[model samples]
Target: MRESYSLLPITELKGVGARLAEELEQLGIATVDDLFAYFPYRYDNYELRDLTDVQDQEQVTILGKVQSEPLLNYYGKKKSRLTVRVLSGRYLITVILFNRPYLKRSLKLEDTVTVTGKWDRNRATLTSSDFHIGQPDQNAQWAPVYPVKSGVSVKKLRVLISQAFTQFPNRIKENLPKELLTSYKLIGREQAIRTIHFPDGQANLHQARRRLVYEEFLIYQLKMQAYKRMKRSSSDGIRIPLDQKRIREFVGLLPFSMTHAQNRVIDEILKDMASSSPMNRLLQGDVGSGKTIVAAIALYAAVSAGYQGALMAPTEILAEQHAENLHNLFQPFSISVGLLTGSVRGKKRRELLENLSNGKVHILIGTHALIQPEVVFQNLGLVVTDEQHRFGVGQRGALRLKGKEPDVLYMTATPIPRTLALSVFGDMDVSTIDELPGGRKQIKTYWVQENIIDRVIQFMKKELDQGRQAYVICPLIEESEQLDVQNALDVHAQLSQALPGYTVALMHGKLTPEEKDEVMNSFKKRDDQVLVSTTVVEVGVNVPNASLMIIYDADRFGLSQLHQLRGRVGRGNAQSYCILLSDAKSETSREKMRMMTETTDGFKLSAYDLKLRGPGDFFGKKQSGLPSFKLADIVHDYRTLATARDDAARLVQSPQFWQEDRYEQLRKPLIESGLTQTLHLD
Candidate 1:
């Protein structure tokens, strides 16, 4: 019976036509099942209370008698205020409602009324959020409020959902096993959905919400666990023996010593490579922590085993940088490295493709161009992707498809919070380089206002005079009328005029790839004293001599991004400083500035960022393949998530768990929702 509802579209509901269907689709509701799943974002309680029991500014509902006639007053264009004096107990409260002039006609002197709104005690005013001509029914006190768009009113949604419940009676079957549901003390699926939309009271609301949240988390965790198992048994992975002698020689060839953290991570990667199952791991390290060298060693291990390697980066600049570094590192061993980007075209591109296909190129590094149709490898064994969040799951999966079950390594500079890792990248094993290399001093950070801009410029001039380059970063490329913040162009112009002889170069997203490279090269060679840019220099553009980073309107950027920008400096041995320029008056902005100066730990900053922005805005966009949960919050509902994960792990390992009748309802989502088809879940 529940399966039948999945096939019924929203148009089947009364009063829902083509236009209304399109509006409902905007809220992710296409079918009757979807409408049932669209839970309310919040609930408004209108339980009646006495005037004496109400606190100042509390949203309260009180039954009263109108003491005077409702006075209607017209104000500014199309605006009106309706005021009525209501007597409740010993107090006479003024019930004020805005833009509700029609209410004045129905309200008469000495009439019984019920009003729900904010109570201002000092002024004896009840600013009406909602009102009833008489006492409202007890069951209608708790009103569910959904997130809606224009032309789709909350009243209309309530009507549609109520009709769905009446038309499809007892059709929502339970998806969880009987034993599991009883153990967890969860309500039935149908009751949970019904109570969540038209909740009876606080207790039932909590119970219903808990059931829905647990179910969402459980399904997501099951998907992840199934995907992980599929990767492990999908095919036989390349069992490459660890070449200790070659790795040791490469390490010895380097001018600097590897940190314990880097060495430990390398050991983990090598272990995964030597296993029969393919390696699906995420490598996390702060900027300039020698992650590249660790990746280099892994690439070396694959190439020495007579299989090709590929490193995919989000941008061409990072890819080219890896190409140059890998070419230099592998030159002593006589292993060839090839670079393929969008600019590498015509005959050169053809030659590179031929070399990669025939095994002449031992290591191939490029951007998205590496995933094209013509690009093929002789024996691709390992894949490493830089800044894994920039690319969606499809992009990453596309690169993996290029090889025959290649061991994949995803590297990121932004440290994902542990809770987020469990939800987003839960399928992959995680390896973190917690320690920075020796001899690198911690970057000194400070937050300041725009009034002291001249002093900050003077400090930058001193750094420039010491033969150290600096970066002046802004949040925007050009001036924005909406936001009165500093931009790259204006900052570049101001810095040029402020400092007489220093060359202030500009870089932003508007520039061509070649132009960006040229400007970055000039700064790298100390030809430009100041490089003013946007967040484009946030990753992979490393200059060892740059000692100062001044971020304008720093409050506008998130904590993780600010940390990435700070990482641009402090690459060299000399003492580095990051001066954040902002005069934001909000407490949240001030807190962001304070935290930026408190610690340089990327993991700590990322956790705080996740807390401040939630998961939706944490990645600056909706991350691909990250579950869009309706009721479960990874940050707040972490304990519930952990429980769901544990339950799912146990269920997946159970023999014939998918085929059992007790688990039959669970298979509907896994199969009908395309989880089985996409991940090939058994």
Candidate 2:
């Protein structure tokens, strides 16, 4: 009989009724498959904790008798409390529950129950809000802690998980190849799944985690190999031969000469453009490295050859900024330019779309809207996506499919470490613009304590008096009553009050799109002397006159993010400064802050970040769209990854392996597990 893995409704499960099904849906468990695939974030081992030899302040589980009924006590206006005495025959411990009077009735006196909680050293007690009254065997020896949502308790979820595992079809397929499993000494899939959820010991859990991590990495390598194969086999649509005369003319139009690094990168791109194979290259540079000018030169060359070119940015503000810069640069050459973004209204958008389709607009710039179904290019020869890491392979594929296999150039201001770049962008060629443009002043960075706020404000006021603008960035948008970090609103209020004579405007994500645009526009025009905002201004919005950037709670942000925020300033000729305010006094924070002072090179900073925080922290799922693995640290296990990559390459090279039934069995589960989704293989 063939095994069936249908997406049955969660309500079909025994314990999941209508209300509980909705709750499970909130946790993203809509089907049996989803529940099965929902891996734990981490595991806890209660098997090592014993009632007889439990130490104070140690996390332990104890099976004891509730010698006394729970009692509720209230002290003045404080929250209500419940206390119960339990005896394990070896010792006695008081269990305190805060503001939970109902727990008193739930556990009656003389009840034998198993309670798992962390012991308190100061009070010599075990106070736990997570404790439950249940049979000893009912509690998991090794528990899986999932990423939980509101209204869901870990104990209840554990019960539901056990029930699900028992009812799971026992004929689950083993996806890993027999040779590979034997080589890695990994356990069978069925046993690994069971052990991962409820392991008998720590060794089994570790083995299960290692197998899963290896599987995740293996699938990732395979998908990347497939993408590479596809790219190699595709036909090149258009090849724009590089012309020195045209390049010289474009360079002559620029007021400042190109940096040697910029020139070299452009030369590399030109060579790719001239080749018969389509270009799949990444152009990485630091902020103010003059990447945009180099891209414009390439686009101009493509347009000069009677073809269309498009540039896609992650944000609408960036797209608009690109359009404005390109319009000014290409106006003398009479190269028609147009902007397409979500903000473009009815008739104007329709007209732009028509112009783009008919080749009336030689170059187009926009956000994700540029990849819409209606948008088309008459003869697109090249496509450049800025901030390439911010986009996924699937989105890039959608843009590339717009034209007849146009050459692609991905750009990013945040430099990626060499190892990470090789792993992430293995299929594509890469170029780096290592130098900043001439006449651009270096941004002097500083790390200051909160006590130096007055001095920073004084410096900002001095800059405002000099007809220059400033940016004060906060980590949060609104004032949270609980968080200790200073929010944009609070900072705006404080700055506005401190500098009453100067113009100060506040901007945050909570504001409407139009409202955000209005504030940004005002800031650009220098009507606002000081713009206090969140990280929304991290990219795209440019003010050449803004010379001061003050980042509050800068230690909370990653190194790459902080670099981008600092890039917002130093676009002008006047000397610029980036002040990083942090309360952290730890060695890690000090080292990170020191990086800002050492150099403005984003590539170096990224490499440092990777070493400090590891690859998982460098490119989180929110930004890179890659699956977070269990055992593979992209930094630590780089050698293993290389071995896997080579092994995958060798496997694909054998024609007989591709046709093998075993290969299908190995590949199918990987596709179903979402690793293929990362590489857009399906």
Q: Model 2 — TM-score against the truth?
A: 0.71
For model 2, which pairs clash? Answer: none
lDDT of each prediction vs. the true structure?
Answer: 0.88, 0.80
Q: Clashing residue pairs in candidate 1, if any?
A: none
For candidate 1, give the lDDT.
0.88
Q: Write the per-residue lDDT of candidate 1 for residues 265-314, one digit (tens) a residue.
A: 99999999999889999998887777889999999999988889999999
C-alpha root-mean-square deviation, candidate 2: 6.8
- Which candidate has the top score in lDDT? 1
